[model samples]
Target: MLSFESAGRGILCNDAETRPSIWCKGVQPALPLWLASHPDCTPYDPASADEARAILRSALQALYVDHQAGFYYLATHDDTCVDTGPLHRADAQGAIKGMYRLRFTPEVSTVSTASTNGNRKTPPQIRLCGAGKALQRVLHAARLLSQDWGIAAEVWSCPSYTRLAREGRAAARWNMLHPQSRPRRPHIARCLGDSTAPVIAVTGYAQHIAEQIAPFAPGRFVALGATPQRGTAYADFPGAPWITLIALKALVDEGALSAQTLEAALRTYALT
Candidate 1:
């Protein structure tokens, strides 16, 4: 019975100022599991088992029966992540479940090492896609590495790669001015004017998941996941943090991300 409008944002949503910098959409338990890896943010109490059960019921029912598709946002504090709003949902068949957000611990500073010459500042954002369990390693890595790298990277917990691909294709179709017309502005393209930071995508699935959805967003996109060497095995839980660091460094080295920003981040932490 959730309205399309209400499902997209969720109830009791947090204001931008009050909301945690990173959060999840689908599962309620991810918040605490993520917190456990970062000892600094420990002593946390995630949603109760009953609350988790309710959310799972509402979400899975929507997906299987109603085919309601959306990513719900969870409001977070040092103690817990309260369910708030839906991120993106559709009231039709092919609805996928699982979405969540994560907040970077407040104590960790994600700052660039360079001076902004009178320009407004924006933090880098990364969209992580996969089942909640799949993204946990990258999430943990992003949290710890962001601080050491001096980049305050924002993490988006994406549960449905297929849904993103579908959304991107539809967006491209909608952006078409004519059959032969080049796309002037695709609907999902991120605005460079709005954010200068590159968006890195980390998932434990096939690399195509990121490739399939790249057209929708504008910023530089870097995807990390299983390769031929790794086969299909999901990344080890312990290696996720450093793996995330490696990816970030790769992006910076490739010039996909601003070297200045990485340098700034390094300087901030005196890692240089």
Candidate 2:
């Protein structure tokens, strides 16, 4: 069976700079590399809600198409926040097709904002993208804490490193489009609109995934992941929630989320 380690070594033995890595026996078309590497996680568990299950199935289909189409392919490393379900397949497909855009919505509503007045206003909120298991943990923790802290935050399930890399490459190849052919601003850019709030990208592959998405952030941006270091002597699952809490607290210290706001929310909750 082809193994990642053997394939990696073979590339090194050859002209490493010029040779491309090979997909091994372990890699499957239905699963992304991030998910493939982790054996313990059931990446797509059946949801309790039929609607959620249907949406997740679409997400699976989207994931397959995006990667097959040479768009980005990424997935959360493990299951956390089971209630949130999987990424939306329709959105994932649209993102890969370079036709997806996110418009900020008021009051955390999931309903589409297409019918809203063009002049609606909302508070500054950061966009959080989860590119892997570690980053997913951070995203979920930050969102829950942010709510308790009364911070406005939006979490994006970003599984596409390839899509972000392809973002501006088209401009070099296609030239300026006819005004009529030009599509509306990308969803990511619209969500970022004029807000001073930080745009944060989190992933285990910080350099590859996080860095690529940073440019799309609306204002201040942060990429969180491991620093260059020696390989680990062993592997173990880090407590996901603990890691998430630590990351969120760091954001709070950075003023990305307000501690005072959380305290106020807690006070209000206590009184009621």
Candidate 3:
């Protein structure tokens, strides 16, 4: 018995409920094949029309394959946009499959590009990861990072933080059980193992959602998201400017950038 329900505030409303169910938030415009591993009901919230279409098709397919008796909730937002150009088919596909490295700058060639070509030095590099609409902001931040600070930023789209976290925990448990065996690596670790550069994962949901990957993140990991202010009932999502600032701050923490440079960026973005 597979049934479906959808609402924009479904996640926000029922997140804390203790039930045998899987909750996927944000705009997931592709298939989550990982659902086969679990028997719980999956409640999905998608913010885009593309998301609704893809999720429906995928959910139906999952229902066809698994004859489990569970309810499938499809939560959708009313806000629709014509500018769906930023949504990449490959990104959504890879993201749902838990591939962290979605887009890389080919010219940069390395995560830590401090190599000296004669007397000229290459820009410092960092990985910026986000999902859904937040990924667009991440892309914008990457461009601004290159243009404003001469930093090489690689963008990664993550559709399911919950899936990544689950895989990470499973890998950890497996590795712990088999101490003598070669440690099993999570998908995120495999994707990010080559780079010692800082990883900044942003989410449209709460910062805690993005923070789930911190335990498995290879190097310096900074999680940014829609964080509730001190006295506000609402949460504010981190935009491109904030993302750029955080990336620069990560560089500063790594000694790649001076404190003065970070301050300059703050003033440049009118954040000060």
Candidate 4:
């Protein structure tokens, strides 16, 4: 029951490669691969917000003892914007793209960010190109999920309701991408083909070297940074928990699971 298929792509909020948990069976540990170390080194293509909070306050002061030994550091941009319950001063990436001088201070702690739009649960936005305002901006940032956290930051995003742009994926499943073409399907691997999860083919594996698949992050790995070996491309892995309380269940903190806490934990696990 240990079906392993390594070959990675799509899932970048600052991908650092982390795969395990029998191979990410339900993926959502605040989409982690590793991001807790920084003195300053930004990488969020077309970035801003005081250069992303001085590289996330030096990546949370080098994890200041893993955040007082509590362990919680999530920072995703996926497209910088603001609105916690009603635009906290609608800081459109610095009052509409002045490019950095960010704000989201409650004293910042951490949660998760950017991941929701296999069919909308929020965090889908990428509009501001032509500026008519419909919202859309998940082009990848939060140093791609605090890639090597260095902190002094304040940003957690999820934009896009038009023209779809959840930017990339850390986890997605809904009939495997479940696209019926709404505003041209919100690219979660282009809404898969037809899936119930448990489908594999993966062309052949290793797009050069990146195949650090992290389904549970036991030994965590995913460098999936090269693809195009020729046809047969298919990947939707996450199923290998023969039992053990469904395998000790871990990895689920995408910033406190919004989408109303993952729909009330799937309506209370569908009433158990």
Task: Write down the TM-score of every candidate.
Answer: 0.47, 0.47, 0.71, 0.17
Q: Is candidate 1 or candidate 3 better by lDDT?
A: 3
Q: Which stretches of candidate 2 lie over 4 Å from their true place?
A: 1-83, 86-89, 92-124, 172-187, 190-194, 228-272
Residue by residue across 54-115, what tens digits does model 4's lDDT show? Answer: 33443355445344222222223344433323323334432221122223332212332333
Least accurate 10 contiguous residues by lDDT in model 3: 8-17
Candidate of highest TM-score? 3
Measured with C-alpha atoms, the lDDT of residue 146 in candidate 4 is 30
Error of 4 at 82 (Å): 14
Off by over 4 Å in 4: 1-51, 58-62, 65-67, 70-272
TM-score of 2: 0.47
Overall lDDT per candidate, in order of appearance: 0.42, 0.41, 0.64, 0.24
Structure candidate 2, residue pairs in collision: 72-162, 77-133, 101-187, 102-187, 149-262
Error in Å for residue 57 of model 1: 5.9
Candidate 4 versus the native: TM-score?
Answer: 0.17
Model 3 Cα lDDT, one tens digit per residue, 29-75: 12233232344544443434555555555555655565434435443
User: What is the lDDT, from 0 to 100, of the residue 168 in candidate 2?
Assistant: 38
Report how far residue 263 has shifted in candidate 3, in Å.
1.2
TM value for model 1: 0.47
Model 4 Cα shift for residue 23 (angstroms): 18
Question: Residue 3 in candidate 3 has what lDDT?
Answer: 25
